[model samples]
Target: MDSIPSGEGLIARMIEGDESAFTSIYRQYHPALYTYLLRICKIPSLAEDLVHDVFLKVWEIRHRINPALPFTGYLYRIARNHAFKTLKKLAYDEVLQEKVLEHLQFQGNGPEQMVNEKEYNRLFQEALGRLTPQRLHVFRLCRQEGKSYDEAAAILGISRNAVKKHMVLSMRAIHNYIYRQGLVITLLYLAQKIF
Candidate 1:
């Protein structure tokens, strides 16, 4: 089974300039963080690039991210800020995806590629949107933003157990949807990554 080192230890190591720890952190948080960015930036490639950029910033400002503080919140704050800035500079429309992608140093696929990724993203975001608002909020806090259950619970005014339940329900719903569509192999790989 795959495992993530404990958050505090990882944060301490990262604070001490351990690249391995930061890499582990980047891998651990990549999926949810990327999805969150995709929802904002509305493009897979841009989201992926933003994830890399966010980590680069994190590594550069490692001293500011206190090991004693929750790194998850810090990470999400950076992502949200970067994504918002990107959205504003690009003027917040389909016309802007390519421009933002270019500024982010990615391929400039005019409209067709953008359309396809946006279509898939629409379905994916819709799936996430189907959850109860509280559940969706918790899922975003815990999975999408990499917050610990307790931390998320505190942020959302819920118990830790509720946080765990929302996460399980979100995963179960997504994997079941994927399975019904006969995407078991792809779902299995995603499962391997997140779990």
Candidate 2:
């Protein structure tokens, strides 16, 4: 389905308890939700589980859907809430957290294969953490999460110019750190060769 759906047909169909229609809704929106969950959580398995949970909640509450509102919005609202909850849960479990970190580790042809993704993830998180919440929010909303400046600004309740400013700072900080550590150069060189 197109990301911009046509009004509330989905909500109406879902509310009417049309099982196949609900399945269509799920199939149409699953990819976007999965991508959002994966980027935010940085763990594919957890992200997949959360995506399942999001759809399950939508199905479980089918009768409660309001036809006047778009079901896509409702679905994403559930996804976002569930993702945040999962993030918090992951923060509390050292073993599970380590597993997620280990799972994200990168491989290379030789010695580079040994790189610990945990260190990179930790550094990225630390750099992000050092920002004020507003700046970090701007950073994630614009860059990592790929929302447009206008969208991010609206979500942050700020002006587009401010969003640009914070994102500039955030990107500069990230790029500088990555470059100082040789990661940026390596990524850039590889990207130029690959694509």
Best candidate, lDDT-wise?
A: 1
Supply every candidate's count of residue pairs whose N, Cα or C atoms clash at under 3 angstroms. 0, 0
Segments in model 1 whose C-alpha atoms lie over 4 Å from true places:
1-4, 92-195
Give the whole-model CA lDDT for all candidates, comma-separated.
0.69, 0.68
Which clashing pairs does model 1 show?
Answer: none
- Candidates in order, TM-scores: namely 0.47, 0.48
Candidate 2 lDDT for residue 114: 31
Best by TM-score: 2
Give the per-residue lDDT digits (tens) of candidate 1, residues 1-195. 746477898888888898888888988999989997776655677788889989999999998777888888899889888766655444334455344435333444323233345554655676787788888898888887999999998998878998899899987886544322222232223223332
Cα lDDT, model 1, residue 118: 54
Tens-digit per-residue lDDT, 59-161, candidate 2: 8988888878766677777887776655555545566555454554433222123335775666667678778888888887877799999999788788999
- Which residue pairs does candidate 2 place in steric collision? none
- Candidate 2 minimal-lDDT segment of 10 residues: 106-115
